[model samples]
Every structure is written in structure tokens, then in C-alpha cells.
Target: MTATSVARGATTEAAARIMARADELGAISSRADALERTHLTPEHRVAADLVGAWMREAGLTVHEDAAGNVCGRIEGLRPGLPAVLLGSHIDTVPDAGRYDGPLGVLLAIEVARGVRAGALPFALEVVAFSDEEGTRFASALSGSRALAGSWVEDWWSFADADGVTLADAFTAYGLDPGRVADAARRPGSVLAYLEAHIEQGPHLEDADLPLAVVSSIAGARRFALTVTGHAGHAGGTPYERRRDALVGAAELVLEVERVGRSSGVVATVGQLQAFPGGVNVVPGRVELSLDLRAEDDASRDAAWDRIRTAAERIAAARSLRFDAAETYRADAVACAPWLQDAVRTGAQGAGVADPPVLWSRAGHDAMVVAGLAPVGMLFVRNGNGGVSHSPDEIVTEADVAVALDAFAATVAQLARRLEPGDTSTAATDEDRAPEAGA
Candidate 1:
């Protein structure tokens, strides 16, 4: 049989396996709601272990790293071909939907299974990354960044809302946080990487498309602002003589929303706290957490600057003290053009409707890997306007099947075209620095 015929057959088999696996996993009651109380607890680790076992069952060599990332590798027929990396995080936000991260990891395993059955020509590695949500730490994308070498060791000391440091949490879970360096990947082993995920937005559902090719992952900056003002009895202080901290905070929140809307960016004030909490007393101080994101770094920076300036001006005019501090920032990542084309072609081959290219407002582990290899992503339609990070998040089995088919087709194409000598060695350098938030 010709190479094209072999590839076509492999694609069919892979798609079938993916569909079956999606059904099996999705039906297992892995809803994020069930795991929320534990919050990155052993429950997630069990899920990762299951994924690793599935990869082994699919005929790959699987292992879990010190940082708890599960990786499965399939050897290539040609010794020199670069390995293709695929998969996503297994961790989810509190009350997250089941399909968000686990689907990508499982689909990658199905691709490997197809290669094994059909004698594909390239090496493949499927990974189920840990800690993408950062629910237990201030840092998000922990596992991916460690693999990319962008994570700082000092961050291990950072704590969660419960005041539990990453180190303490890892120890509680039977993992040694000191061995985090073991998670870092050698530079240049991966030639390309691809991830399949739920749209996490309403675009695909609204457009009635089964899939989407990600154009880029938006850059993000998080900040904490504090406003301090004089406190007085609510009944005793005249409205005109008072310097209410809540008033300044409220205005700043509105300003952030207004600026984001007018600039075509996205900004949200998700958390706010008040000091001296009592209805009878005027608010003496306020603290707010602001999240800003944009499709490009420049725009994200500009939006942050605008927000800071607005906050400072408002505080000064209201006779209050204002301070703002950055908590985290992730740069925008553009998908590789060739890989994107491959994704589109794969969807076409799968008999799915033409997939649209769209920007992702949310971040993913794939963004970190893009700096190490050619990277692209596929997104399945999510119901209810792509609502995610909630128990109500939903996606149809058919949409998942379609995404799986596309993922397999694309992996098959890459395997056939990869050359042994082309394997990237850039990741192997001992001194090579990992990019931030990789």
C-alpha cells in the first residue's frame, strides 16, 4: 500500500479509538464539582495516574515525573526523526467541567495508539501536565512552566489562599517539591506540539461550527490594588466631608470596565475586600484584584497602564491613598502558521465542517510549549456560550469526537513528514533558559 493509503487507514482507526475513549472518560463522573473541596487534591493525581495507565495500555512507555506530569512515548520507525509532543493539563479550576483539560491528554494517547497499530513513521509523546490551574499556588501553569524551564524555584515558597505553600502541599500529597527541577524537559527534543481543547468560549457554539483552530493565546496581567481613606460613623459623617474607600474602589472598577470596552480589550475586577466590615461604619479601606488581558503584549501593557493611571487619579481626587502591584503576567503566544494549516487540513480530512481560526482569551499549557517547538491547537464547541470553570460547562460527545478525529489526522500527517535529523536539540542545552509561563 502507498504511504497515503497507510496514513488514511491510520487516521480512521485513531478517530474510532478517540471517540470510544472520550465516551469512557466523560462517563466516569470526573466533574470538577466533585473535586473542589480538595482543590488540587489527590483526586486529580488519581486522574493523572489513570491517564498514564491508559497511555501504557495504548502501547507507549509511560512515566510520571517528580512534578507529577505524566508522559508517554512511542518510538519512531526512523531513529533520527524528531518527536511530536501532544497533550494538555489534567488539573482544573474549582468546579471545572470534565472536558476542559483531560480530553486533550486522552486524545493524544489515542493518536499514539493509532500510530502503534498502523506502523507510523515518527516518535510521539503524550503528556498529562500537572497544576495548570494554579489553584493551590499563586502561580498558574506550574507544570508546563517547569518543563519549559520558566518556573522559579523560589516560587515553591508561595502559598495558596489557605496559607499552604506549594512545598507543603506537595509533601502532603507524597511528592517532594525539591525535585521540581526533574520536570524540566531537555531543549529541542520536540519538533512540534498540538493540543485539543474545549473552546471555553461561545464562539464555536454561536457560529455552529464543530471545531476551531486557535490563532493565538491572549497575554494577561494580574494586579492587586489597595485604597485607603478616613473612616467615620456612617450616621455622623456628612456625605460631602467623607473620603469613602469603597467609593474610590467602585469608580476604579467602572473605569477598568469602560477602558476595556472602548479599547477592545478585556478587564475584570473579580475579587474585592473591605476593611472594618460593618454597615454602620464607613469603609476605611478596600482591596481589589484586577485581571487584564489582550490579544497582544503591547495592548495588554497599555490597558494596565491606563487602569493604574485611572486608579491613581481617582484616589487622589477622593483624598485617599492608592497602590497597585502586579501579581502575574503571561505574554501572548502566536500559533505557528504551518501547524495551523495542518490543523485545518486535518479537520477537512475528518469530514468535519470548516473550522474557524479564533484567538483564545484563556491561557493553556500549549502556550508554554510553543516557544520550544512549532505549536497549534484545536477547540471543540462548548455549550452555553462556552461557559467554563463552572459545573454547568458542557460539550457534546459528537463535538469531542470531531475534535479527536482532527487531532489524530494532524498527528498522522506530522509523523509521516518528520525527518530523523530534524529533531530539535534546542531544548537539550543545559544552560538554555526556559521562557516565562511556557
Candidate 2:
């Protein structure tokens, strides 16, 4: 059936089922007071089982990959074909909301169940990637990276907070450490991948749109910066005589905010600590964490240059030694034009013409999967100012219903294109920004 003729994707049944599934998954967490599930843990395994059952019911052949990724697939006309993949992660950070990663996985299953009747040209694969939150090993996207053949040996040696090694965790989880490579999906076997997740921001809610296409995932860089000076008695040291490291750090923090505001980038100093911090002493040293993100790679890097320069100048003038080191860097990823068009077409087919598009500031399994194939994403509006990664995160079922319908339409639209080997014309990134709701 054509996308235009397809009914609302799996309806409220799908939405309700997703909510129920999320609750079950949420219950299998590490903490009684909050949701805290980590990779390669019992909670993760149970979640895999729970999602696997839904995949099976959707008429897809399901299994847990060697890397512990819960995967389900519906075959194409033949036994093998380049598959269209859909999904998000099942793992969560400490006290995470149910909607962030879980919602995407559930919505993908809903799409799969709704589209199985059409039996399109390409096979469909739904994956509940085992790890996207790096709570267990301090390495995010572990599951998707394995699937992308981007697994690094360094991660094996990675340890958790309690000094549990990843290799040890694998063995404890009854998974073979030697077989994680088996999860790597070959490059040519995937046509595209799509993920439906919470917007994780207030843009969609502010604009009163329930669904939006994701144009790109922002690139991010993290740093640990230290400013060192001399400590002195607060009562003895005059303001001009005191070389305070904390004061320098405070100035740099303000600079970061100003740059972020004027540059339209997101830069945060989430952590700040002062050595020799006392009510009666000038601080000797200050350490801070810098998290910077931008919609594009050039802008992100360029902004970093500006920030670093400003920090150096500020520290030099304050006579405080400044040292900064990058702890992590991930490049931005743009959604494939063909996939973006499919999402647009899907939204239109679902009765939303020119639906708003959004750029995700947060990372997801989609970023890692982009290494495997072309990627697209649909964002569901979030509640409570779109605050995610916490228990306060929430979603309205009506928005979810709308998101599922659009996601299903996206599946159908892509299926139609796959049948004919058609690639839609590429559009400018201006289409990626959120516009006033129509």
C-alpha cells in the first residue's frame, strides 16, 4: 500500500503498548528509588528479552547479537537484501526517563508491525542497541559502534566506576568477549537507518509540533581545564595582590557563556572545583569541565578555537597558569538527503505538510549507526521544557501517536523509493531548522 493510503501507524494500541513496555523496562533498573540500568547488566539483559518479545510478535525474526544488541529482522523477497534499519538504544543513564531511548525502540517496533503487511523490497531490521549511555564503561555508543564495525580494542580495557572491566562484564553477562565483532554490520548490507526519539529539547514543544525530522546530530567536544595560581590568606591578601585561580576560572566561564550565546552554540561548564578552597583563603587552583557542541563540525571547532584563545588570554592576564586538554571529540553527522526527504514525505503523507525539522543537540544511536549506512531521525515532542536524562522527563501519548504515524509513513515512503531505486533531490539545510507551526 502507498504511504498516502496507509492508516495511522498502529494507532493508540501501539502508543499504549509502548508506554507499558517502557514501564516494564523501567522497573528492571539498578536502583529502587530511580531508574539506573547499565550495559552488560542484568537489567540490560532483561530489557533485551522484553523488547525481543515485541519484535517476535511483530513477525520479525529476533535474536541478541554478540555484542548484546537486541536485534529483529523481517526478510525481503529473497533470503538476503540490503536492509532498512530502524531503532534506538535500550540502555539508560542513572535516573533516566523512559522516553529518551526506549521510546524510539518502541516506536520502531510499532512501525515494523504496521509495515510488515506491505512486505517491501528491502528487508527491515529493528534494533534495541544495548548501550548508548556510557554509564557502565564510560564509553558511549558501544553497542552501535560494534554494529558499525567501529569497535576499538581500547574499550575492552575500559572499566566502570567500581573498577569492573568491560571484558569482565561481558563474561559475567554470559557473552563471549571474542565475538563482539560478530555484531558489526557490513557497509553494503544497509540501505538506511532511521531513529525516532524524544526531541530532548523544548523547540518542538515551544512550536507546538508533535513530530519533526532530524537534519543532523551536533558534534561535541569535552575538555578538562585547570587554572593554577597561589593561595593566600583571604584576610591578608588584598584584591589586587591576590592571584586567585578560581577568579580566573570564573571569568573564563562567563566568556564561555557569552560565546555560546552569541555564536548559537551550546557550551557549558558543568563542573567546577577549587583547590585549597576555604572561607579564609584565596583559591590556589580551579578545575572545570567544558562541554561544547555545535550543529556543524566547522562551527564547533571554530568556536572551540575562540573559547580556548579567550581562556588563555584570561588566565595569562590573571597570572594563573592555564592548562586544557580535550577528553573527547565527536564529529557532526548529517542525515542523508534521501532519508530526510522520505521523512518529509512521510510527515506529509501523515497529513502534516512541511512539518518542522530539528537538529539534535544530544547524541544517539543514530550517530553511531550513521557509520554503517545513511541515517534519518524523527523527533517526538517532549514535556516539561524537554528536560531529559532525568526522571522528570515525560511525554504526552497524543504526541507519541502522531510521531508513530509519521514514522510509519516514513517507513512506507522509503519502501516505495527502495522498490524503484529512486533517490530524491537534495535540499538545502535550511529545511533542517524548526519553523513556526503551521
Candidate 3:
């Protein structure tokens, strides 16, 4: 298939709207020279203000919540009805690309603007979560977690690179850190969360499709691992006698890859360090960071189990000591089947029937929101082989057009499906239902 079908076929004024809005928001970064907005910063407040204004322009009542989330809402036909939440984060990683999180927020606003002409059964809420990148803190998804009623007071102590505590930053932002719990939404108040983001992977571009549906967002487990062994002179220590921690760690890294391949999970050893100042000296110790992810918790936990066993064996054979400390664990979440079908129907309605489906490996605010509401995502193909979280990240106008059209249709379709008062309760315990959820 040629790019002509999507790249040329999809050209709506809405694409131009999205493009212009993205550039405008992209310019509101923390750094004058680069995009680096983080949670509770001055730049973040500016971005939130801009998003709030756009939300109001989209015909919704807008405000910033206690946890600093930007929100705009168009109420349903009747009072006390559950809402359909459409959104993504507004924060960015350091020197990050403009599109990663903000595109979803902007597209969501555009979709709401498109459908404001009609009445829907469920309230439509557009949220620009304040902190998804965790750039200024250790815990990720702080905004969404607060919305999900999972806020932890301990996070207030989370310090940024500058040693400023989250509470201190919140105070600086004119928010009472103690009132952050007000950000949490009661369970069942939301029908679903729909996010439209760049694919951030190569599949959609490889298939020459402008848009795709997300199947599930991967659950991730992060660990800091250390391998300790005796230090000795590299030249004097015989290969048979040396107990090299770095060598043992290297072998375990391969084990991580091997288990991940066989288990169908994604395991990464992104950070590694070796001890000893001299290159000629044998490494005394080594530390590594392991990130393991899977679409289901069972598989992810299983992979971790096998990896632990392998690490133990490697250490035993090499006369090294092994230790691991888990730093983070976010459970996997699958889109509701009905919502998945809704996105597909929206794509089909937009003339891209049977588009490919992709699963997100990277974490997002959706992971936390999924605990409170069913979630669905629309993935627009990215240009330049899906490079993301960098200055190189990009999207084509044609793809944006397709995404805007499909996302708008998705709202209308979901309204029809949910009009019968059968709102949001289908997957209340999706976290535990691996087969059905995944």
C-alpha cells in the first residue's frame, strides 16, 4: 500500500486545527530553548492555562483540579450520569517531543468541539493530567492516580533534581498539597477514558496506515539489581580463579533477553555500571536496572520469577552475590472489548476499515485511569520510524487528519452504545480478569 491512501486521502480543516494547536502548546515549554515542562512548575501552569482556554473554546466548562489536572466538561443530557473522559497528560520528559502527551489532549478537545453540536447521554470530560512523565518525581502518573482515588501522601516528599519536594512545589504553584486528594474521582463516576496518541512505534507506519487501535497497555516492573564479587588485578587474576561481578551481570542480561523472548514479554537492561577505576582491574561489583513488561500480569510476574531463578544460578556458579530491589510496578490494562470495537467502528466509519491494532509498551497516564474507568486509545502513526521522547519525534498532517476524524466518530459511536443506561460497569474488575481484559 502507498502513503497516498492515508497521507492524501485524509485532509480536513480539523487536521490544521490540531497542527496549529500542537505548535502553539509546544512553544509553552519550561525551557526557552527546549520542551521540558514538568509537574508543578511555572511552565506547566502556563500550559495548563492554555489547555483550559482551549477546553472552554470547545464548549465545555473548564477548571484546574486540586492535583493540578486541567479539566473541561460538557454535561450529559440528564443529571447524575457517568462521564466519558477523553484526555492525556500535559507534562513532558526533559527536552521531549511536543506530541507525546499533548496531542492526545488537543485531539480530545477537538473531538469534543466536533460533537458539541449534538446531545450525548454521557457527560464528556476532557482532562490534561499534570504529571505523567514523572520528570520532577519518582512516582509516575501522579495526576491520574489522584483521579483514580489512589493518591499517596508520601509522594509529597518526592524531590526533584533541584531537591525541591513535591509539596514545596505544590505550594509554589499556589495549591494546598493537603487538598490533593480532592483530585480523586469516585469510582463509577466515569464511563471510560479515551486517549488518542502517536503510535510511538513502527507498526502503523510499516503498514502504511494513518490510524490504529490500541489493544492493551503493558504493565511494567522496575528493579535495581546488584552483583557483588571480589575485586582483583585484571592482568594477575586467572580467568578460572577470578570472580567477576560484571561478567556475571553480563550473562544475566543475556538471560533477561532470552526469557523475555520465550515469554513474549519485553525486558530491558537500560542502565548498567561497573566498579573499579582502572580498566586493567577486575570489576568488584556491578549494578543494573531491569525493566520488565507484559500485557498481562501473570506473564510479567512469571518472567520475573524465571529471571530471578536465573540470576541466582548465575551468581552461584560465579561465586557472586546477587540482590534486587523492585522500584516500581504498574499493572497491565486492556481496553474494554466494546470500546475497542468502538474505535474500530470509528476508523471504519472514517474509511479505514480493518486497520492494524498495536499494544503500547511505554507507560502512560491511561494505566492509572484504567483502574477507575474502562479505557480505549487511538494510535496515529508517527513519522521517522516512530522515534519518540526526543526532538526527532514527529507526526504527519495526513495522519493527524485521520486521527481527528476517527476520534470524533468514536465519541458519537460510544454515545449511541451507552445511551441505553448501560454505562461503564462492564469491566469493573478488569484488573484481575487477565483473559477477558487482555
Candidate 4:
């Protein structure tokens, strides 16, 4: 058989493997609501175990690190070549959609299956990050940050709304928090990272695209604001004399919304609390959490400044005490250009119609790895305008198959690039952009 014939055969077989794995894994019902029965709590350890089992089943060497991150290594023809890291978190927020994290993990397994069946030149590592949701703890991206050596000790000291520290939660899960440093990987160990995930938004669905190549992950800043004012009798105090914290809070909220709209940035006041519960009493205190995000750090910073200025002015005008405290911040991350090109080329080869280059407003574990290695992402369309993080999140079987084919083709291209004495050129920037659909 000719070389072209062999290549075609491998492509057909890999596509079949991807679809098969997607069907098998999608039927397993890893839904967050049903996790309780499987001993898979929202905790990190349970997720780690679940990923380890999948990795083992895929015939890879699997293990958990001190941070409880589960990693599976599939050896390649050459042992010394840099390994490609794939997979995402197995953990989820409360009542999250099943496909959010599991899709990436299962896709990695499918990638490994393809490589094993057909000859590949570089090693691959399937990773299930320890904690990406930060449901039990205040810190998000625990596993990926640890791997990047960015995990801070003070983060463990953080307490949830229930006052449970992250360290205590770790201990309850039979994992030692003191050994988190063990999860850190030496810089330059990983050659590249690839993640497959649901778009979790309306873009792809609205565009009617099957898949998308992610260009950048947006930066996020979270802040907690407190407004304090004198509490008095609602009936006795005149409107002018009353120092209403709620009123001040309302003004700040509206200002935040205005800033977001004017600047074209994303800002949200997701949680709010009022003090002095009484029908007739004026609220003495109010607290709210602000989530601000943008495609870059400077824009994120500007958003934060706008919120602070608005809050300060409102508090001063209303004669209230204002406090703005930052809780968390993540810088924007751009995917490696080479890897982005590979993804586009592979998608084109797999016959995906007009895959778009897009940006993710939400953060992923992939962002953490971007600092350490070349990282790229592929997004599958979610129905209903790609609304995710809810029970209604959905992905079609056909789209999953498309994503799998694209993933497999990209992996194959990367493997060939790593072959001994292979000087094959990479896909150029022009190739990374989306093509017009037929």
C-alpha cells in the first residue's frame, strides 16, 4: 500500500474510535446530580480517583499527586520526546452539566486509544486536574495552578461561606494539604497542552458552527463590596435624614452595569446580602460580590477601577462607609500560535465546515497550563445558545463526533511533527483563522 493509502486508513480508524468512545462515555451518566451514588463527591479526591480509573482502563500508567491531581501517561515510540498534556478537570460546581469536564477527559482517552492503535511518535499524558470549580474552597484552578507552581499557601487558609477551610476539606477527603507542592511540575517538562470542551455560551450555536478553535481565555477579577450606614426607624426618619445602605448599594450596582455596557466588558453582581432584617427598618449594611472579566488584563483593571470609583462616590453621597476588597484575579491567556494552527488545520482536514477562531470569557484549567507549555483549545457547540453550568446544558452526539475527529487529526499531526528527523513545517497564522463554509 502507498503512504497515502496508509494515512487514509489510519484516519478512518481513528474517527471510528473517537465516536465509539464518545458514545460509551456519554452513556455513563457522570452528571453532577448523580455523583453522590458513585462516591464521587464534589471534592477533589473523588474526581482524582474517577479520572485515574478511566486512565487505567485506557491502558495508561495512572497516578495521583500530592495535590490529588490524577495523571495518566501513554508511552510513545520514543521515550525522550516531550509529552503532550491533554484532559481537563473532573470536578464541577454544584449541579453542573456532566459534559463540561468529562468531555475533555474522555476525548483525551480517545486520543490515546487512537495513538495506541496507530503508530504515533510522541508521548501523551491525560490529566484530570484536582479542583477547577472551587465549590468547597474559595480558590479555583487549584490543580492547574499547583502544576504551574502558582498555588499560594494563603489560598488554603481561605474559608467557604460555611467557614470550612480548604485544608480541613482536604483532610476530610483523606488527602494531606501540606504536600501540595508535590504536584508542581518542572518548567519545560510538557511540550504542549490541548483541551476539548463545550462552548458553554451562545456563540457557536448562534453561528451554527460545529466546532471552534479558542484564541484566548479572558482574565477575571472578583471583588467583595460592603456598604455600611446608620440604621434607623423607616417611618420616623425622613427620607433625607435616613442613611440607607441598600440605596447606596443599588446605585453602585447600576453604575457597574453602566460601566460594563459602556466599556463592552463583562461585569456581574451575582450575589448580594442585606443586613437588619425587618419590614420597617432601614438596612444598616449591605454586601455584594462583583465578578469582572475582559479579554486582557488592562481592560480588567480598568473595569475594577470603574467599579471602585462608582462605589466610593455612591457611599460618599449617601454618607455610608464603603469597602472594596479583591478576592481573586486571573490574567488573560492566549493559546500558542503553533498549536492554534494545528487545531485549525486538523479541523479542516476532518471536514468541519468553517470552524471559527473564538475567545473564552470563562477560565479553564487550560489557562493554568498556558504559562508552562503550548496550549490550545477546541470547543463543541452547546444547544440553546450554548448556555452551560446548568442542568439544561446539552451537546449533540454528532457534534461530539466532529470534535473527536478534529482532536484525533490534530494529535496525529503533532505526533508526526515530533517524529525523529522530521522537519515538517507547522501551520501558519493565516491557516489558524476560520475558513468560509461550503
Model 4 poorest 10 in a row by lDDT: 1-10
TM values, all candidates? 0.87, 0.94, 0.92, 0.84
**CA lDDT of each candidate?**
0.75, 0.83, 0.83, 0.74
Error of 2 at 390 (Å): 1.0
- Write down the RMSD of candidate 3 (Cα, Å): 4.5
Candidate 2 has an lDDT of 0.83
Per-residue CA lDDT of model 1 for 1-438, tens digit only, reads 123412333344555555566445444443432535222466666676678889999888899887778898877775544577888887766655667787788777776766653254556788888878877675678778777766767777888877888888888877787787877777667777789888888988889988888888888888888999988899999999999999999999999999999987889999998888888888999999999888888998898888889989999999999998888887888877767877888888777667789989999887887656667889888898789876567766666667767777887566545533556332233322234342
Candidate order by lDDT, highest to lowest?
A: 2, 3, 1, 4
Candidate 3 global lDDT: 0.83
TM-score for candidate 1, residues paired by index: 0.87
Segments of candidate 1 deviating more than 4 angstroms: 1-33, 37-40, 117-121, 159-165, 168-178, 416-434
Q: How displaced is residue 273 in candidate 2, in Å?
A: 0.5
lDDT of 4 by residue, 112-192 (tens): 654562245556788877677776664677778888677878887888667777788778766788887878878657777
Distance from true location, Cα of 185 in model 3, Å = 1.4
Ranking by TM-score: 2, 3, 1, 4
Each model's RMSD to truth, in Å?
4.0, 4.3, 4.5, 5.7
Residues 1-438 of candidate 3: C-alpha lDDT, one tens digit per residue:
111111122347778877888888788877888988888888898889989998898788898899999998877676567888999998999888879998999888887775542267778889999988888887678888888887877888889989999999989999898888899898778878899888888888789888898989888899999999989998899999999999999999999999999999999999999997469989989999999989888999999999999999999999999999998877788887778888998888777979888889887777778778788889988888989998788887777877877887787777766655564443446432231121
Clashing pairs in 1: 80-420, 81-420, 186-427, 187-426, 187-427, 187-428, 188-424, 188-426, 188-427, 368-438
